[model samples]
Target chain A: MEHEKTQIERHTSKQFDVELEDVREQVLTMGGLVEQQIANGVKALIDGDSALGEDVARSDYKINTMEVAIDEACTKILARRQPQAGDLRLVLAIAKTITDLERIGDEAEKIGRMAVHLAGKDRPPSAFRQISQLGGHVRQMVRDSLDAFARMDTEAALAVAQHDAEVDREYEGVMRQCITFMMEDPRTIKHMLDVMWSVKALERIGDHATNISEYVVYLVGGRDVRHLSIEELEKEAARAISPRTGQ
Target chain B: MEHEKTQIERHTSKQFDVELEDVREQVLTMGGLVEQQIANGVKALIDGDSALGEDVARSDYKINTMEVAIDEACTKILARRQPQAGDLRLVLAIAKTITDLERIGDEAEKIGRMAVHLAGKDRPPSAFRQISQLGGHVRQMVRDSLDAFARMDTEAALAVAQHDAEVDREYEGVMRQCITFMMEDPRTIKHMLDVMWSVKALERIGDHATNISEYVVYLVGGRDVRHLSIEELEKEAARAISPRTGQ
Candidate 1:
């Protein structure tokens, strides 16, 4: 009877491990696709290519499908495995993280839609410059946040959160400039709103990346770092990574 | 051995039922608080009452706390109970629903913050009139969605999803008016942006409400209604609520 019980336990453990890895791989693949969508959307905006924008918009269906698939997989695993402790935290965090990724995809689609509207509209070169700069910064943040999650690097995740503040400041600057241009020329009002909304979408993507980083922190240390100031997060991260730090 | 198995089954089922009820009650309570926050936030905007706006902003912490608590409870239930079939779907839907509720609260807080910024600003009476009309409509949608959720009324849920399109139209109308006003008077640009964002936030609230309604459909019928058109959703709802209608 003891030998039979041991065999059953081993079988279940192996199956659970395989299921967890499969879900994680799919999540990373979804993340990569979302990142590409963002890039393609912004490139369409800068290049004034509505066709490219349409392609990006069309590709979002894949991201949405992936989100639903991952969520369903997570639910099935929870019902079947009932994993506990750190494993459980990882599963829950992954489930939550996918929601943010899906939202990021949605925002990217919004950007793509805006790009389509801005196609062939006369805009100052400086607007494109600002969009490119802001887009690059947020895209790097997204990549780093996902990498942090993959590597379980709490410090890198914390850095992504800190980077979000800079993105916010840049977004405000872009908005001010766009408003100024609109005020100077009434003809530019519609196009400027498009630029303004695109920048807002990019800034929100930065926030979602920050959220993903916070989830990484939670998954690694079982501590939710959301709604915390950078200073507070830094202190918490220090303790989370090394409980005896400064002691 | 058969008698022992039956006794254990009864004990576990009773415990699961109690836990599920407790979580459901808490979720409804949280939903109620969020609804109040939206009303107060919109009132502050319409009244130009910065004091009321500040109150809404401060009250958001309570909503955030409730979200965290409800989420924790759901996670615990998922891990320990390992509920299957309909029970599992209910728990997962509740978990997903709370995230949307929390975001709705955040949107309210954003409106409150914008209201404070717009206090004493010089704006046309038409802007306030438009805001009042739009805010009232979306607020009703929020209330009806919650009521539908509490009753598990699929028809009401489907109706809320249909109503979101109207909110979107009103939002675009408001945006056009705000932009026209800003273009006519450069001095009003900053203030108009605040009003513009407030309306945008309200529209987003309507979307969240729609999402909650979809969750209700999912919870009751074990169907995922996300990413579906309103027409598609209506058909699914019809089939879900009346499984043997065609038969």
Candidate 2:
């Protein structure tokens, strides 16, 4: 009878572990969708393709629905499993991560809107170099941040945080170049405005990705590095980002 | 024995209601703090109070913490109670509403950042009328949206959605004004750019507030009215706003 009771306990505990795994799988799935959306949205902007932008916009609704469904699923697990301490934190982190994912989807839609707006306008006479450079930086930030999340690399997350300041600097540069174009030729204001909006969206996407990276840091290290300076943050990031040699 | 079981169930069910009431109370408490932050952020902007703006920015961390706590509390209630149907929706809506509230807090901080950036410059030379109008409209939306949630007034929620168009229009107007300001006076360009950022933040807060209203409407009506027309939205808003005086 004691052996049977132990067997039942093991089965229930295994089931609880399975639920946590399920929650993680959902998060990674949603993360993949968001990553794809970011890539597609930026490509839409670069290629001047409204059709691709339309696709990105359509997928945002799925992210919204997924967030609701995932929240429900988590609540069910919490109710049935009655996870305490660390298990509870893991569930809470997943819930928070979904919110970040959904916001990333929203940022992608904003980029899509800009792409749709810019569909009719030609790139300005000479500001493409600066805009393209800024785009490159933003794309890199998004990529690195997501990679950090997937690998649970705190260093990468800290780098992502540092990258944001540079992205902001680049955005400021783009704004200045666009301002120059508008001042030089009034007709370009419309297109330049759209470009500025797209740049803003990319910057926001970078911010959200950094947020995901921050969450990974928190999950791994159990510390809040949100408001820390780049140098101090780098140590935590390094510790988190470095892969262990063995299990 | 069955009758004793029935009485116990009734007692627990009442306790469940009490728990739900606690969650709702905390949600509103958090919402009230967020609304005040938005108000203070904008007041900092209008009054050129950079210190106040900094205060708003610093306090955003507290808002984020409050949000996580509220979310955990709501999920715990949902899980422990295993609420069905309407109770489920109410809990879910509260969960969703907290996300909107957190985003609103972010928007408020964005406004504060813009305020600090614009502080070095003199007052807007471009009338600044639309931004002020939009600020008021969005503030009212935040205030009344929370009221609708507290009262479960679908009519008030609908009205909030209808007024989103006003916010959008104001955003467009700000866009144009900033573009023209850049074109007409290159000197005011930097300040106008910051002003546009402030207006953008306000526009988004209005959007989030409208989303909360939509949730309230859906929570009560159990229908998706996202694509509904402005006129129909206003009718629903009227009901939520007026509360008990419909006769």
Instruction: Provide interface RMSD per model, one decimal.
Output: 1.4, 4.7
CAPRI tier for the interface of model 1: medium
Query: Could you tell me which 10 consecutive residues in candidate 1 chain A have the lowest summed lDDT?
Result: A238-247
Off by over 4 Å in 1: A243-247, B244-247
Tell me the TM-score that candidate 2 gets on chain A alone: 0.86
- List, residue by residue over A49-124, the lDDT tens digit for candidate 1: 9999999988898998998899889888988898987888888888888999999999999999998999989878
Give candidate 1's whole-model lDDT.
Answer: 0.88
Model 1 residue A211 distance off true place after TM-score fit, in angstroms: 1.2
List, for all models, the DockQ compared with the true complex: 0.63, 0.23
> What DockQ does candidate 1 score?
0.63
Query: Number of the top candidate by lDDT?
Result: 1
| lDDT tens digits by residue: candidate 1, B149-240 | 87888899999999999999988999999988988887788788899899999999999999899988888777678888999999889878
What's the CA error at residue B167 for candidate 1, in Å?
0.7
